[model samples]
Target: MPSEPQPAPYLPDPRIETIAEWIGDPVAPAAFPRHQLRWHNRRWAAAVGLDGFDETRWVQHFGQFAPLPGNLPQPLALRYHGHQFRTYNPDLGDGRGFLFAQMRDAGGRLLDLGTKGSGQTPWSRDGDGRLTLKGAVREILATEMLEALGVDTSKTFSVVETGEELWRGDEPSPTRSAVLVRLSHGHIRIGSFQRLYALEEKAHLEALVAYCLETYPGSPPPPGAPGREEPAVILLHQVVERLADLAASWMVAGFVHGVLNTDNMNISGESFDYGPWRWLPRWDPRFTAAYFDHSGLYAFGRQPEALLWNCAQLAQALSMLVETAPLVAALDRFGPLYQQAMGRRFTARLGVESRGPEQDAALIQAAERAMVETGLAPEQFFFLHRAARNAGEDDFGTLLRLHAPTVAADDAFWRQDAPPGVLIDEVERIWAAIDQHDDWSELHAKVEAIRDLGRHLG
Candidate 1:
């Protein structure tokens, strides 16, 4: 955990100030304040102008829920309704976490500092709202891997191990507890609009749509499309494109975002709130990350389907206030958009550029067939033919040679005996060291290695 020297002071500028009614009143953080700030993401902190703060200040705000100067005076538990496993559930919101503060990044995009296990909120059904230290560690690993693979993802800004013990039905009981702060483009989900629709709050619903478009602005509407005539339709088109791009990114990265619930789908299309996430071991489509996923609904290959279904739910919400024709038009673009995004991202990851959708699609099919034939995980096939590093006379190698190199093959991480990967077994081994002996040497080393992979991919 290297520190940022001579960082700037923290300041808050609330761009989403108009929609305060959507947030629940702030409650006090749980009294489990041992204040052991374990991991701080200096990369994100610097971008958010938080690099100047010391560790103590970090713990006070992130761990203890203290308000930052000029920031939100109180934390806000956001309100939303979501569908879980194809079942619409109107009783879900921020259960264990809340939006602590809102600020802007170096790119001037609005960012929300939301928590995972700060404490219970209005939606705390029947469980204690505390995060296990292992959970925080897993998310750190997830975001690191996703970011390295160029997947749009939320950055784990800070993690603090609070002095508490939690019992859960999932992991071993009496595990240590921690708090995680995530920096995202926006916390508003498709579910947020659903909640407003459920309450029959048309004005609030339209307000949310307006807020989202203003905060997370997207590209101009497609040339003279119907969406150009309506702001809500325009927003829907942007979301559909983003979600399509997000789904393709997951496929190219070999990531299974175990749960693809409506609540987990950020309107900004950034991936966050990782639970039971796993990297693909092989190019198998039926690989499911969550153990309880008996139906394989959110499997590795079905990720695009799940995302498209969630997008339909968003379209459904927007339909309440506007006509369905333009929204459906936006939804229709998802298929072709996904294909193009997948081809572009897949080729970029393999260090090439797409010729056109047809040629690119053929190349993608050839690459997948090659991976499937040998059961080569992305970690193997990508680096095996990375920018002319290990080209061969095979079809896949010949396909690679046709495309000119886009990146210099100077990274030792890719040339090493084993390319960087985040399989479940590896994650468990890293966790076992900490769970048994509180030794984070392996975890720290993994973080550094993942950073190197990010640099290599860049």
Candidate 2:
């Protein structure tokens, strides 16, 4: 019999080189004391034609940072500046991570393989560039949960425990260290443009804009939208639309990203870099995910506002390429787009068909009122009323009855009394099983449960 056929190798696409050299700094990966393979995203690995890698090859490339064939010979620590909590900070960049390689997925869409804790770079500043093992685990859970909930999010590609101890004020002393690799559409951020604008690199900024438009093709701004013909204006419009949808998705999922800095906002509008994130335990707009967020600038209820504010920063960057009027026109689209997105995503979460915008808004209002009056957690409320069933004979029920169920009432996911959630408590519980007992059963089970939830939602 003939031997089994081997899968074709993935072709690397180092497209970031299309931009000027000032955009990034090439650097070396840190030497690790050990490389213990922890988590491998076989599903996504298969998408990028890397599923055949064994543990040794996986550790060698991901943990040891050995350059992949025909890819970036040296990792590039990306450069950009952003406002951290609304304060401009020009000192920011890829302090702890770098672009490892680029490859097209099975669909032929360009994707990036970036690292989170692979090592330090010029942007490390006064802090050491190391990620705690627990942090990596939390990121895995966050990405999985977000992806399940239909958020456009980065895929946590790999986690390798590097034998080292790291000290941090927030985590336990001398916590375990690890390196994480994430797969994303692109790593260019709104702040990347801000950096170019700040440096007065108008020519480089224009090149970057053109590169973005070509690499991440988006629908042209709807006709009659201001400056729809201008490249900068078009990119701004696409970013606004994508971010609006993203903000709505998070609201429907009851997620608080904890941080909404301009740097954290991806140009592709994909959610990444999970830090201090939390899901709403109850329907409260003032719910915050970060302990240090004293002002609640990014509270659950204000996520849309925060995202719009970040969009304004992007507009400011693009001002160098276009007039302010068109950018403002693009910015003005966020409100209408966000409302529409909220209606659509909210109805989907409830497993009901949309009954037009006005009726959808009414249903959403009724649901919110029900949550407040009944004090039901968002997950519990959604699960209980999935397919618009079990809604009490109240205003919410009346509005829900106006819409038809999108899925069978007897669907497996809807049959459960509670929705599968990766709330903070669950995260801590899963981490405890790993940290104290070195057991991974809970983590593995939770991932499967989340995926099941995704399938049912579909």
* Number of the top lDDT candidate: 2
Off by over 4 Å in 1: 1-9, 406-411
> What is the Cα-based TM-score of model 2?
0.97
Measured over all alpha carbons after superposition, the RMSD of each candidate to the real structure, in angstroms, is 2.5, 3.5
lDDT of each: 0.84, 0.89
For model 1, the local distance difference test gives 0.84
Which prediction has the highest TM-score against the true structure? 2
Instruction: List ranges where model 2 is wrong by over 4 Å.
Output: 1-9
lDDT of 2 by residue, 1-458 (tens): 00111233587888887763888999999999999999998888877788888999999999998988888888999999998889999999999999989887655668899999888899999868889999999999998888888888998999999999999999788789999999888999999999999999999989998988887888999889878899999999999999999999999998999999999999988999988999888899999999999999999999999999999999999999999999999999999999999999999888888888899999989999899888988888988888878867899999987786645579565777687898788999999999999899999999999988877776
Each prediction's TM-score against the native? 0.95, 0.97
Q: Enumerate residue pairs that collide in model 2.
A: none
Please give, for residues 263-327, the per-residue lDDT of candidate 1 as tens digits: 99998999888999998888989999999999999999999999999999998888878888888
